[model samples]
Target: MLLCDTPNLVSSSEVIAGVSDHDALLAELRVDSRRPTPLPAMLPNWRRAPWPKLNDRLAEEMHAVLQINNLNDAWTAWKTTLVGCVSECVPSRKSRPKRRLLPWLDKKLKKMIKIKDELFAKWQVEKTLESRNLFETARRASQGAVRSRLSLPAPRAFPRRKAKRVENHGERRRQLAIHVLDAKSATGPDDVPAVLLKRCAKTLCPSLAHIFNLSLRACDLPTDWKCAAVTPIPKDGEKSDLRNNRPISVTSLVGKLLEKHVRNQLAGFLDTNKALPDNQHGFRERRSCTTMLLRTLDSWTAAIDKNSGGHVHAIFLDWANAFDKVPHQRLLSKLQHHGIDGAALEWLKNFLVGRSQFVRFGGARSEPCVVSSGVVQGSVLGPLLFNVYVSDLPAVVKTNLVQYADDCTIFREVTSQDDVDELQEDLALIDIWCVNNGMQLNAKKCVAMDLSRARQPRLPQYMIGGAVLEYVSTQRLLGVHIARDLRWNHHVDVQRKKAAQTLGFAARNLRGCTQRVKRMAYLTLVKP
Candidate 1:
């Protein structure tokens, strides 16, 4: 969605106009309740072509071309051929099944609703006691039927519960705050269609053929094309606080596809060469954060089983803005040290330097700023690049290191003060490595937990950077929660409650849906 390099400044009046238009459309949808209205259609896919048919056409085009002088030319021709064929032959998907938000409205209910509306209309016009009574009775019957079908408790006037209305009002305020900037920026909902069209054209064209050719080297990237648009999202706290914001980059879809293609090649190369360390499970083939957590848990369980009374000191490292703060120069140096060179090294340098992004809050955009450090936040190459950047940590520190991306944990079997002192030395070595690599440990966020059958008579003081680490009874890694004692009870309980809440929402809204629909919704939303 971050397709535009530059955005025009928008006025508040233009935004208000769009919001008013949107509100009008929503109001129109709510006007009629007696008869079912046709559901709105899903947006068209501008780039979705019939792959089976298009592939044959593309093959014929490729076969007709006898010679390509440059690798860049070949890549450009291939992309052009694909776009020309696809743009002409793109097929439409089948229409989605119509859905009703209030699915419980049947013929009988519809009749009752119609009657209620008629009586209400008459009461409004006549302003008579008899007309009002008729309207009230019809409305009560219609409302009761709805409540009965949805299994909702009867409405009651509870003075104390009136306070809950404040919560609803607060939610409206939050939505308004999030949308105000967007509305004022003159970026309307129609921007998506325009962006998609532009993206399609850009992909089909050969403006960056040279960049695509560099992918053959599988180490480097193209120049200005690699810059990403960064947007800030609040990190689950008070929205007013700037500290709670985290920038997430939204890059070009075409660029992402190229990056993925290059990533696959580099991943294979790294795997075959065994250039990456085994301790690193991030962005590698057949490795994930979950896998890393399971391995760490396995090690913890094994140590506990081997020595019932022995303690394993587990310290989870937190780097402040790990991806955003990566020193580009240091990262490139690390890559070179790991044997990445030639066109690939140059490409990486071009990819990292002179990148500019403007933050977008709703529709309003800030002035363009240069990004001097870090990997692109949402880039496919980011995790792999980070892994390469920190791959030497195991060599730098003599301890059991388990890493999944930037979520690193180092632990050692501890008994006496000597063991604790040695662990502190290992921490210092890691800190030094981080500094050398243009990374800093967030000591405040970093946590230490002692895993043992029995508590040690004395606990060790752990310090990272200049700040001491806090000891926690439990911490969540990946999506799984782990207690100091390594019990699954906390995780199980949390998952169960979440599932119940999801199911409750599904049951309420999906009351009159078909059994098959209900089951599908449950499996898709609640089960996971």
Candidate 2:
């Protein structure tokens, strides 16, 4: 009964009577080759567009000031005009005689997948431990072969702000476009290429500014702009499971350009009001993993250098799905506390609420689902918003804390068992904070590392959410590994081996490529 009409799909059908005590039909399909995936007819060939004429047309149309009445209508009109200009200048991608196949799934990946299927069949039939293990190994290899390419509390009475208009947003818009709008970046769901915006920034800034000002002044975001196009990238796990993959969303880049402006304003407000603690090292200007590690290590070394046989007990807290679990109402309340109120706060509320996202892999797409919680995954403002959401986390932790966004490392200098008890109390308070804020702490992955030179080092147990944290003598903090003996040999060796393997892969594939390509390969693959 199994039939396949497609040329690429070669099918084999069989009937077996012994399988289920009845005649069972078995069908197998082999996709050895396929034609190129046809892109949506709407996506224009923007790279070959008449950019100068496009710019001139956009300028001529948008030179006049828009008389705004209804916000959505205005947005719709602008989008229509923008589309019209593009249609006139840019050629459709369908104009091509034949499109080439995408090279993401090659012969090697196909071969590995075939091996994995064979092993799976063997394991299913034999049902032995060794066979199962071999199957799992093959599954992991197939997964790897395909993967070679890719908080916070509400505040009480806060200041209500008078709305202030952005001054000279035209110039600011032009500057932001020049810096943040990358020509090479992916196009959003709107099918507008970033190259179009970046190249025509000079001519389009006025109209863009007008649109942006309308959004800010009216405290409204367009419906299309809020819809995110999500792309799921494989993570370090079995790729067959959806939960193991990471979702990176591509929201409207035009919306994101406005987000950048809002981000700057919000950051300035936080800095002026001192809302965030210095312990936060993620997403802030001039702070990174290395800086956070240096400070954490400095605190440990200082604690250890003291003559009282003082030891530092550190617990690295992991927030489970930290970005995805951010509550929108809680975030807005915190933003209000941080002096972002009135128009800015309203704009953010509109931005975060009623958003939808659809997952896209190649030419396929999932249905768009409404997002009730969490900021957009691959958004320009997600990190900053999360930081603001958990701004008060450091307050609850009584001991020394180093935070890089959600990855919090809490430690204390312990001279006696009483100090350990005090640190334990701090951990209890953090657990309570997570409960009150709808955040889950991954205590199973949490670890307590005691930094001491003493032969008889006291490593105490820590508990969060009734789960005991494991004790570890060696842990990787940031990218650098920390050992109980404070040696760098293991870390250096691991990095060396990783670099060598990556270099070999690059070299094997890049034999006939140019020197420039080889250099880029090294920089992107091996050097990093």
Candidate 3:
């Protein structure tokens, strides 16, 4: 019984220490196999003794008999006596009263009786084993077999490969070669190589020259490049003349204003406190600048009038791996052509070097560690540097192209099919520019649509191939969510009705209260 309850017993040290005393009693009962000779020869009177008190002796005796090593011996002794009891207690139908008299005896009944006898014999054997001195030994051996079968092997581990020293050396050499090439190419304004300028035109302003100025500034070009030394000759009778070769200084009042406005708009997003170094060891300051530039371009585009019949054509360009694939020599030449000078150029060169580090989590006592690529997103100067490199393309193509980061949009005044064809040619040039700068045009995202159709009261929808382009009205941009069937005015009317009902209910309730108050005042006066 104690062995049966052993699983439930909680020990101060371990939960299941050993078997219970009930098991010992069962084992002893099975071991005592001697029986009374016959019923007539039995003692005149037989009485049951009081239960034995539990003590250290009983525990010692049980421990000796139930040793795990002697399990088989104990089990065999218990089974012998158990089998004898089954043979005597179970009845044999062959020796039963005549079945002809009762007429109910059959083979099925005999089979059932035999089955019962067999079951009884098995139970008696189990009970005898349970009462044996080696019961605990038997139980432990059985449990051990089960545990051995269920046990799993410890997992094998593979050794990690050490980073190759030769690989690091090669990478360093490649980086050094790039740096040397960039330095050698960095010369004067005209020194900006044709290839670099062409790339910049493609990347910075494939549609308009105005964006070139922004890209130059974003790139941190030298002071000289910030100003346009040559001015454009105005059209006949236009506001400005072509002969004016005065240098347009970025430090000038208008230039400063533009810079200030762009910075001010970006201030909300530029969190200096959170800025960290990126994987390339550069800070990400350009994201804010890019955002500001895009917003400014959007605003400028929206200001164009549709009623004047001035059609706008825009294309957004996306460069694949813009930062990673930047040709250092080409970029340097572009910077030189733009007028980037000594110290600024040197600082940029140093900024390109990559650095790495490891990171850990959890606490001092129990911590987990992991190795990963260094910070690449939250760096303070990372965005600015990236924007500088990316802006070069738009700057050179600014004659007709408008670029806000990778998003390029070309606008043209279209009247006829000839005009559309001309715009397409210009767009093709823009695509070529992108290809030159290691950028690819994703044709799926690129769209060319007519603003005239878009401006209609109920605009006729257009599709590129089979895919419908979303037509957004200027009015819809002003916080109005437009659906196919629902109009803004209809929503406003519903809101207005709801508001009026709410006001009417309040007024009615107030009127009732006011009348009651007046009546009370009159009653008080009359009572007085």
Candidate 4:
């Protein structure tokens, strides 16, 4: 008999109830939070030693501490000494005051802010109408004062009338125009301004086309071009912690333009050559998470239709820093395997090698450090390179693998216990592949789910690196809620909540705004 009919799988409601009880138990064991959480301790701005000075000190210390010629050991020593020097120069301040966001905030505004704070404190102590009214008045005055100081023009008082939302041909054209303008204005992190990009693209495309047709090309890059500026952005958790941040590169406008052309050529060539598997959907033509989901559902349905009474078990695999961890040499080998060589390959190698980056946040910029690995983030070619890097993963693993860029789901239909063993074997094989490819599986975030309509489903426990994977009743695959029973009620409920939140934001911000603006917000934000 299939595991789904084995009377072991718990119902959704039962799972929810159990989760609630578990949460209650955790809350009881944890400390009560009667007071507000304190802000993170941060170093003073003045104490932040200049990057050049830190680098000099770091070099001296690394030379003194490290005797080994081993590259890995040398790197470890360098990082350790660098951290020490940084800490010595810029020590943490536990009681440091919060940094003000507004630079132009004057003494008058500060006084008003203090008054408002006092009023709030009083209201917190004693809830009275007079205190509340005073607080509201002070808040409005302080805000108005700030706006007035900034020389912001006051809105013209027009007679209030509800604008009709009735759509016509003219309105449709106007809305389309608004969308076009908005998209044009919304440049990404590494993108040049729309005007500059248009001018460059127009002038460069024809020459670029000619270059693509050339049989031989030199590996020389422009010497005058500045290296990309690297900025550290918080991945998650406390921003004050250096470990929480990852480097993002901002390259030159011309570099981005050239990369855009390369990306287009590479994507076309790969698609035409059928180098990417049909299961690989991300960054590929006419493929998406939606299509992947539909195909997965169809496959499972077909299995059921075969009268095999099999259960579909899926493992959503996550990689730790997938793009950043790709081995450059291996990537080059893969590109060559896919018939990319000569000028194209050499240009890509130039793009990848000897790249330096500096950490920039706010006004403070660090000294440049050489980046040994990873494709440049925020570049047009980054995703394409990553796709090509992991394109052959399907051949490495035995099971049905569905990939959306780095997001992968391995699924197999199981009837007997022997089939469950096969699924585990496939996971082991994938682990070996990841090991060889210089990537690590984030076993904690990985989850296993059994998809079945049967009342009870029993599936084998999967492990990666000796860590047993968590079994989930519902798993979110590419922003879509997927459950064992394939019911969409949970997904719909989540989307409805998100839509309501967006609608509330529009109601607050676009209340007195133009009807067209409101419509644009509705269409782009709420509708999606």
Candidate 5:
């Protein structure tokens, strides 16, 4: 390609780049050496901050926030000192350019493209219409590659860092907790942003780590840490209706550093001792809703194949306000059963009890309400503690219960009518367990699903808490739609509609946005 009107046209030629074929050129060369892209303003790369200067400055003025008597003033002063120290000591560098994404193009497309070029060359040499038609056909054949690239997104895996046992385990935990604070997260009631704390983490970590360690030593946290500012977010329907919105508690951002550390220790202890059952997949590391669904579906498929024509009957149960219904006494008892006692257990007890919340709507805040039961609403330990609370849920069915947090399901291979009866008996046992634990299943919302090929003419009734469960042909369990006939048409159609809705919404609302931002619709397509 040549710029026909350009005055300084010394030379232009293609260079062999590994990314491109011999017949093609992927790189663009322009002799504009005099003009260079100006570097953007330098931002502090705190990850490589000067630690000696940071520590010295931090240690000097950080005492202003160490007053345990007035935590509110201390926290405010802490943020100020951190900001000062970070600005003074942290080094700044030119922002690095974002790495360009060049997803792989398959060999089949390359082969077809080569063939198309060959046919086009032949057509040019022989001046044959048939060769030209063959070249055109090969060009259209590459649309499959285009569609494949657009429709399917390769799953990206991130490498995880594991904890190593060091001499100062407590110090290490505090450092990590402070370090991993989400930079973009919304701050809690204290008005001190997590992002601000994160930026100064290098300078603030040692001092923060010491404060956290003191809390652990005495097995007691500050009152301010236990306090939360609750904000009601609309879950569905009208925003004006308070019932439609669920309370999302925002505990102190500073407190989260301590909370996360304790949560990790408790989780690690549970994982090491294997206190949590295989059935309970809630909040545990390396376990997710997808894994739970996979394990359940895999076992059901195996059972069906082994029995030659077997089907699995499953009942999905939802607990009413499960997170808010966990009794403190019961949770402590369960923790004790799992062999967590002495200082560790005492720390957990203090962590749980004496927690209070006040709803914040607009400018005014409601009176602080003392919460007696259930775990902290928005804390890191909430779900883990909830999972532990119901860890002893009966796994009476053959499939040994599939659970993710409060979502519970029990399934078994139904060889005969007796097998279905056995499943009902298991459900009865679950009802009894729920009653004992001060937790009851929302029987009205409970649904029964049959993962079977053939539909039974008269499906047997299943009961929980004297309420008959409704059976559904297609039930969505943990985000994935499960059909009795095992077809993905409904699931695919639903997702396609959602993506279309999202795309349409973006296009309509983002008319004022720049091209780069408007291109988010394309990224949204690849996101799912």
Candidate 6:
């Protein structure tokens, strides 16, 4: 009394029976249950079913019945019928068809389509206008709205061109001879006058001509040649030569300067009247480390906590040209105020203002060129000099801000609109200080986040760039990647791996470490 007569259904049963292993067959059955099989196997009698016509309600009903009954074979059969129906419903391409319309329906559909298109166009235009407005606002804010205060001067009109000076044959020959002589007498390609250099070295030294042309090109040079060329050299020539000769030992000068600066600045703070004990170095080192660590920890905790009940906003500031743009006179005044004097002040001033050369590869060899300001990038004293210059800002703002090198992050709790406004004003003052000190704030890199918004009940988050920035539960820091939700077993596994590595290294080094000692060392090395 079987109603089904599909040959494919019989074949499917035969394929299922061909699997000998029980587990393997069961796995195959699980896969088959989830998805449809090929049409040939699932529906051998698919052609026999009545095909559903275009827009037929019965076609949907038939498909629904197959799906509800979990009949994959029946679904495939119905799909084939549906495809055939669609092919029959499609109008012939060669024949021109007359449009059949109800006047009311035609008018409504046409009106709806027109409205949709108009709305789309309107939306695009509005979006573009909004974006342009935002850009203009940001640009105006960045430029401090100074456009109204300033007026641009009118461009100067060029005078009429003069007639060309056509040289005589004898004059041309004389010029050529002078150029050749200049080239032969030149110490290097750069030594010759640019025009003569180019003419002489056009063929044999094409690069020389190119370089000469580049040098002769109009540029912004000092109006006073004396200021440009007559730079002061060291009065103590012997000491200058010694400093140049022993660059590595230059740290002695840095240390002596640092010691003097510290003494001068901390004279009032320190009990100068009392005799100072030895071991100041150890005491200073420990104090500095402890202070820095405590400050860092406080910042990290404040940044993480969201619902410990505070309206916290953190702003990070970056200064553009922090070292190079420092005004020489201003810096000297500040140093003098701190009691730095005599030879030390002179040396420091010279070090800050001295020009230095950097060599960059230009294909075959390194080409050397001088820069006007800033500590030389790879020089030993660069970081020390930079740190010294920027040391004042943090000291002044220590009560309100935390600073590490160039990065200063300001934190404040705001519970009301007034508080927020006040915080913004405070940040503006900081910005002004930076500007006055020849630094600039990088507004884009700065983040101002509200910590009150969190998706989870117990989780803390900060709003950054319109998204919640949660503390990373798992992250890599200083090469070690820590796992989130660390368990006892996982910790044990980590320790075991680390122990094996340590033991291997020890063995290679011909050192002894027992298994127990190795495990202890591993635990010590990797704290969590």
Q: Give the candidate number with the greatest lDDT.
A: 2
lDDT of 1 by residue, 138-223 (tens): 99999888766655332333224222222345334332223222212322211222233233332323323334554555444333
Q: Which residue ranges in model 2 land beyond 4 Å of their true spot?
A: 1-42, 63-65, 95-179, 307-310, 510-524
Q: At residue 491, give the lDDT of candidate 5.
A: 84
Model 1 pairs whose backbones collide: 15-183, 182-363, 220-344, 221-347
Which residue ranges in model 6 land beyond 4 Å of their true spot? 1-293, 299-307, 360-365, 376-381, 394-399, 451-528
- Residue-level lDDT for 104 in candidate 6: 29
Poorly placed runs, candidate 3 (over 4 Å): 1-310, 319-325, 355-377, 390-400, 453-528
lDDT of each: 0.68, 0.80, 0.37, 0.68, 0.75, 0.40
Which candidate number would show the highest TM-score if scored against the true structure?
2
Give lDDT: candidate 6, residue 524. 50
- Model 2 Cα lDDT, one tens digit per residue, 214-326: 88889998898889888888997554558888887887878888888788878887888888999999999889998998888888888887854667888988999988888
Each model's RMSD to truth, in Å? 15.7, 14.3, 38.1, 15.5, 17.9, 38.2
Better of 3 and 4 by lDDT: 4
Candidate 2 CA-lDDT value: 0.80
Candidate 5 per-residue C-alpha lDDT over 5-68 given as tens digits, one digit per residue, 9 for 90 to 100: 4333434556455555545433344454553343455766667777667777887887656654
lDDT of 3 by residue, 1-528 (tens): 334333323222323434764222222221225532322222111012111221222222333223323323433322233223223333323222222332233455445545555555665687775445344444455445434333323223333645533244533433222222222232222123222222222221211122223333343322322222221233434222334222111111222222333333333332342222111112234544345344533533553454444444433334443444555555555545545556545544433333221211111111212212211122233345454455544434432454433444454545556655665555556566666865555555555434432343322333332443344432221123222222357557555676566656545533423444434433333222
Report the Cα lDDT for residue 177, model 4: 26
Candidate 4 weakest lDDT stretch, 10 residues? 23-32
State every prediction's TM-score relative to the real structure. Answer: 0.66, 0.77, 0.29, 0.61, 0.69, 0.34
> What lDDT is reached at residue 268 by model 2?
82
Q: How many backbone clashes can be found in candidate 6?
A: 0
